[model samples]
Target chain A: MINIKKLALLIVFIWPSVLLAETMEVTLLYVGPTDSQAWAGSQQGLDEANLQGQFLGQNYQIKSVTMKELQDLPASNMTAILVDASKKNVLSLAQDAKYSQVPIFNLTSTDDALRSACVPNLFNILPSDQMDKDAIAQWQAKNPDIAVKAQAWHEDFVKFAASQLNKRFKRNHNVNMTDDAWAGWASVKMISDTVARTESIKSTSLLEHLKNDLSFDGQKGDTATFRETGQLRQIVLLVNDKNEIVAEAPLRGVKNGLDSLGKTTCQ
Target chain B: MKFKSLLLSTLIMASTAAMAEPSHRVFISNEKSDSVSVIDMKTNAVIKTINVGERPRGIGLSPDGDKLYIAVSEENAIAVVDLKTLQLEKKLDAGDDPETFDVAPNGYIYLSNEDDAQASVIDPKSGKVIETIPVGIEPEGVAVSPDGSLVLVTSESTNMVHVIDTAKHKVVKNILVAARPRGLAFNSDGSLAYSTSEVGNEVTVIDTKSLSIIKKASIDLKNSKPMDIKVSPDGKTLYVTTGRGNSVAVLDADTLEMKANVPVGKRVWGLGMSKDGSTLYTADGVSSTVSVVDTKTNKAIKTIEVGQFPWGVAVDD
Candidate 1:
């Protein structure tokens, strides 16, 4: 009798989520090579997103597309697109009027000009060149004698569960997670996270929420959010040649918050 | 001579009373460093450091305050530490990947097994697993109700708080919360419970009796991804550690309104409070420091550097 009662409770608990699940058909378009680092990261993100989506009563599908096939994409039906293309292609894709409504996540490009473009539809996951330069400058300003450079992602970054992410990526793809991969993963994860939390699948609403409401924990110890420039304000790792993450941009003692790393106000 | 003797007697009595005062100490678990730093609360200084074990995260004191339970995650065990001697007593099996946990009034160590998606209730006296209750996936936070009737585990991936019936050892209800709810704290009377959501960027207030959400408030500060939560002893105020906000937020308990965000070290996560509820000790993970916040002033009074990646803090008064 006790087992029956417990079983009833379990059914009651599991039934509603399964029954009421909206079955939101969200397609996450990836405009990149399947063998690339960014695609591997994005693939892992999709897998994790599906896991999270199951609980949220949503389903996410990834469609690998090319530059030529961009026009063939179900622009109206798709929820979002993540790009791992060149700076020119990214800008052109964002500027294209056909997919203007679809939110585009630039997964690989780090051109400062892209951020300066301030395309409303485009959200750059990779920090701009200026953001990296500024981060390194901040660290260099403190230690004038030591020369440092900026990095987007490092496999050795143990904080904020980066090690777990790296391990999972390596296990899934048989390769170390790179900067592009982190960006790709960040894009999918951010979209899935926003959709799950806000329970909104509409492109415009997701874009608005992505711009204003969402705060992503990009496995970077702190809050990584989108700025007015449509670029993610994230910590840039000061990685040296031995591929060791020596320090972070917005270097602890010198600069203030994450905003110190990137352009906050649009010109 | 009589007057001088009387004066000496009074001095001795005062000294004895001072010594009798509850020895105020704060023990912080440094996960990456594999040690616990003991701080003398009166002076707020690191008086001693005990090498507990690898990946020590969750920490709590026994009901009698005689022992310390540290969740050594990598080893999948709880390190029993004799507080008096500041030494590790033994490691008790706590199931798989115990990250955070809470101590019940009944002196049972309730832990969250993240990897297994379960909460294991261990009897500290005998060092035995009394009951293992199933819960949601990636259960990160374990919070026991003030009355010890419920053991709540917040699962990160599942985004639900599974409330375990202490008496029957059954999962009574599953309460849905925001994304990545990592920490939880109940009011002084257990009438209400507060939880912090890391990715959702909100603090949810739940009616403990109803097992329903009362309110959800967005953290006001920029990059405010709240991690751990603590309610003042009086139950009128809440101290929430904002993860990426890089500060501690003070909120009105009833209104769930953000009152203040006090600046602290980078990536502050675990929180412990003094017996008087006048001070809060925050374990800053990134900077590897503890910020001692005076609740009255809503400010960080001192910063004490600890071992690498300080995770959880347990205070004994």
Candidate 2:
């Protein structure tokens, strides 16, 4: 009877920890072509998250759907979306009441007007047109009449494990990891990271967590913070004519360079 | 005249010996270049670059500081280099895809087998694997206790740190941390252990006696994904290398509070401290440079260019 009592006490201590390890299956919805690099990155990120989950009790999976398929889907399971479509389609999807609370990331479009619209749950992963203009304007302010060109990512960027990430993508897909692919990968990274940290999968909590406490390592050699305008503050890579990154802007000397790059607020 | 000539020769020998050698040296494992760049810590100069093996990553030194060990991943062996001659001494079997490793007090090499999801104990003298302990998948970080009674291995994919008892050669406890745990370090007394979660960007401090987590502190810096961590010899401060944050985050060891972020090279991966803990050497993986920081001021005073993709830094003082 004493031995039985000791075994009972052991179960009571071990049971709660086992219950806490219950798997959290986070399902992500990819909105792009099946063959696109953007979708590949999202898929890769889903795999990465699942790999992380295998050890710590979280299961991440991705599903690809068309614009039409997304409109009719219910928001009950709270599937997050990664959009790789035109401005009109992206805005339409963002405006849909069904996905209003859902975390939707705009992976490709760069329209400044879209940021001005300020969809609370819609994350603009890429830099906007106005951000580019401001980056050039800041550059020209210092040096007038200088030609300026910039991009979201450069293939040759070797820092921040970008080269490692690129090599992985290249080995898996047999192509260079494109900028859209980077945004797609970043979108999943941001969401899964929040899920892991917050330990919650609810759409409302995810949205609030992103709005109030949003600092993501988007593999750009710095923390990627989101603006109230729903735009990710990024360092625009200034490229030369040969399509190589020459420098970064907000320039090295710019104070609070990360915050200086893009619009801080809506309207 | 003969006695005077003998005195002159002794003076010349003493000066030449002083100029040829320094009191300390730093070794960096260049992963992509498959080489080890030897640097003179006193002068901050690249003294020699030795081609060790295919994809050398984790670099370490023997307990007595006689032989340098480089984990040549592709070769599935540890390249042993003679400290005096700076030559490849021998290669020891380290299981498959060995990365980060540590030395037990008994002079056994605790190697983390990443691909096989296990940790191997190798006898350095005989170059043989005497024991294998199954751990979590993708084990990357290996740290032995100061007493050599326990060794901990962090599994990157599993998000857990397995604490293995050296005497039993078995896992005694599995401590869960945040996502993608990468590095592990033990304090001087073996009373506490700290682990850095790469994806979660948090450091979990563990009380070694109870194996319970004392606290989990967020690095709290933008773009700071911590890779490797080291505690001061006095155990007052903890230095962590922020992967993309490009800085060495200094934290109060007692409170786990943020103290300073000393900016270093891009993608700083691994770090080491001098014996006295007055200086720190950080390997910036992507920029292919090492940043030497003065601990007194918490500032990087010099940056020395190393081989391509310097992954691990081992300082022998």
Candidate 3:
């Protein structure tokens, strides 16, 4: 009848002081080295959340963990894990986080695997490659001249930019296609801004806000956010030989010519 | 009783005379509101609202106090405001995503373009881009040395501090720092420069002459996400705003230690120190308020509500 061992374990792990501490400890898992620009930028965002008291009464702590670290981490103790879209290790990290029931925020380049995998807690800030393609198409519908130019230039630039990006994409099965990769930077900025606005350092709330209300004002001028299903409302831009910009054809949500560009691409 | 009353009246009259001196004007850029709110020094009231570009951020006044420059991130340009008329005089193309800037003593303006990953040097008189010095990734913050010989730029993406020679307009060296370095400020002596790393939640102290990070002081706040950094004129204290924390973290400049965290409005994006260096003004983006802090007491003296999403801030004496 006496359960002294269980009581001692509970006291050590669930003490009120540890639970009600002023600072919330959060560990962010990144797929790449912490020094990389993209990961470094994300780390900065986490630091900003801590500085601003977003995790009030909860000290915000971040540890840049790689794929190897994912295996070693006690998942139940981690607040959230952020995976880079371009990283080859993303799939493993996502799978591990899913098994452990740890929430994952993906800054991925595609949505096929995420949607197909159907992880309830997995969310992405960046739109998929298809969304980028569709965004350009919607934009083309609005500016026919720009669309024509983009179509003409696509043949020239696609070969070079695609080849450069394909090396990494091929290694990550989750990535099926490549749009304007420059959108990656915009996505990072958008997510950081959203995190700053929501002021929710908690992993759960941050994930929810990113999925529901965070609208990405991409470099290509698309104002769209991610859906619960992990699809994004995005505008795609096709780059030409001269590195000039354009929108593609066969728009999704065009009602009239004037409102063509304003159409949302989220599924 | 009559003599005592006369003395009291005389004392009150003297105090009123001293208070009658003109108060300095603090200018705030409301990014979401797309306007700059000018606050009167004495009354702490918004004196005027001037419209700028799409998203007004990184505001600064010329040394002469005759002109004000606002970096419009959305528009990818800078709006020059004539202090006399309080009207936008001209819009200058400043590469891409012009966020922060520093005005040199020689009337040249050095601005960091976040998108272009470069710093554009502008001749204020002509409003022309003299030279664009390519540095590290996402150059967000810039500061010029007191002697105007060297310019320092903080690259958020690359996590490096680029030191540039003013004469040649070229990056001489790159000093690595903590993550997401956004804010840059130089000490009065120009011997040292302070940079705020948003991701690192720390302030990096750099030896200007050596261009090396001497030490890093961790700011003790949850997100201590320091954005805009301003050194007092006396050079005794450093003021940093936690963009997400909605508060200002003060540090002793000499000791390089965190002194206090004074609460401000939501999302304090930009900060400005008064000409006298006694008062600090911060633009609260979300709460739409400018929290005025008395430097000596290190407390929020007044909160002047302004346009929606106030961003950059400047002071005119």
Candidate 4:
């Protein structure tokens, strides 16, 4: 004695909800506490992309996982992963056989060694240490008067950068920008830019676009493109705690197209 | 000795008076110094630095060559400099954040306000705003046609060129271009306009009549960031300043072909041509100098050091 009218209404209400809930999952691997400043920036970028509906005809389901959670998951389904882990974890995860086919955006690490590691699937969103060093060198060459010495302690600079981010971060959670935070924000933006260009949800298509035809507007008033070494070539700005631009690297004086600041040729 | 002094005085007076139309003075706006550098063509020297105000950019002269209008960006006003006296005559209240402007043939000045996202049409004589036409975001470059019927404003963020009807002060058409279109130039006939895309590393030519992009040509130099563009008086050649490449790219205007890439000073941004159109002057911001390029030989003849960060240049002709 099935009630036909009641069953039909239940089917009509439940089926669209199931279809609507279907979304493209973007996994974020957090090595440390999610509340940290570095992870906060990346989260902000993901939220922005979701609000903007950057992906074509699809909704983004952001799934943030801890290192333990990531390791426990079945690795075969990994499509795209954003790595907000320590340099060591980033290196190990990149080489891990489980996520070999997955495209990973390295958000927190700037170690030059990561670039030399020929992981075809890994892309560095932030400028590498060598790239930043070269930029400083170029700036020093142009402006010999500015004594740009490499110091071990610049906690104040990080605080200032974080404050700058805090002003822009509109959500209920506010965090200062650390190296990881800046990298996270930049990495999400780089992916969003590539996705916007490709207009495809398939991971292979996105990876192809990132490797071959990706030029991201890093929101630094300039466009940054990937080098052969998987490093992002961009204009690095040196600023003080007051958020004033002290100097910009790849300064106007660096001759022969070196002002773009990175590896010129692609690998 | 007395006769020699008398002859010297006579020579000076005669030279000053004879320097009438097609004058050999090049004026450059220095952003950091808040002044204008006046270069003497004969001596190839900066003879004067006139204090204008904060962030003076986009220098252009009236058709009569008696007045020079400078976009003082910080003050949100246009400073009119009297060329004869070499002094600031008055300030006209333009829109907010005026980055660049051009003088129409009908004597009206079209200015692009970067933050305001609109262009102010100001009558230079009366110092009154004719109208403010809303345009795209972050308008950086402004160009008026030779016939003065229309003006083009390039918005960097929007990546579109707003073709404005000068008579009605309305946007006639919106032609999309490459990323970060900074500066533009028009041919002698007002039939074609060439715009430089800073990030795209390309130049787009717009057919004025059709309001369509005729063609786009990529800059061949490695890591080229083409910023400012200028066409020759005869419209035979196009000169584009590659910002990061530190060179001026020469192109065939008609064929849209790359002819030469002349190396100049570091970080060349603005360009000015001599009155005779035989020399090209580059306002090199990073080098703090202006490189003079001989058009015939396509070589840098001289580099005259100027104020800090010279942003724009104009010739008195």
lDDT (CA) for every model shown? 0.85, 0.85, 0.68, 0.76
Q: Write the per-residue lDDT of candidate 3 for residues B1-317, one digit (tens) a residue.
A: 99999999999998875443323788888887888898998999999999997988888877666788888888988899887788899998877778789888787889988656689998877878999987765678889999999999987655568899998998877775655678998988898899987765678889987778888887888646778898887788889999878899988987778898899999787888876788898988889999999988899999999998888888776
All candidates' chain B TM-scores are: 0.93, 0.92, 0.90, 0.92
Q: For candidate 1, lDDT tens digit of each residue in A33-150?
A: 7888988888888887776665556788888877788787667777888888899988999999887888999988899878889888899898889988898888777777776668
Report iRMS (Å) of candidate 3. 12.1
Candidate 4 C-alpha lDDT tens digits along A23-65? 6445444455676655777776676455334223234544678
Q: Write down the lDDT that model 4 would get.
A: 0.76
Q: Which stretches of candidate 3 lie over 4 Å from their true place?
A: A1-267, B1-23
Off by over 4 Å in 2: A1-21, A136-148, B1-57, B72-77, B92-100, B106-141, B147-183, B196-204, B209-213, B216-228, B239-251, B257-271, B274-317
TM-score pick, better of 1 and 4: 1
- Candidate 4 ranges beyond 4 A from true positions: A1-106, A109-122, A128-206, A217-223, A227-230, A235-267, B1-24, B40-47, B115-118, B125-138, B157-162, B165-179, B254-256, B274-276
What DockQ would candidate 1 receive versus the native complex?
0.13
Output the TM-score of candidate 2. Answer: 0.75
For this target, which candidate reaches the highest DockQ against the unseen true structure? 1
In terms of lDDT, the poorest run of 10 residues in model 4 chain B is B15-24
Candidate 4 lDDT score at position B108: 92
Interface RMSD to the true structure, each candidate = 3.6, 5.0, 12.1, 6.3
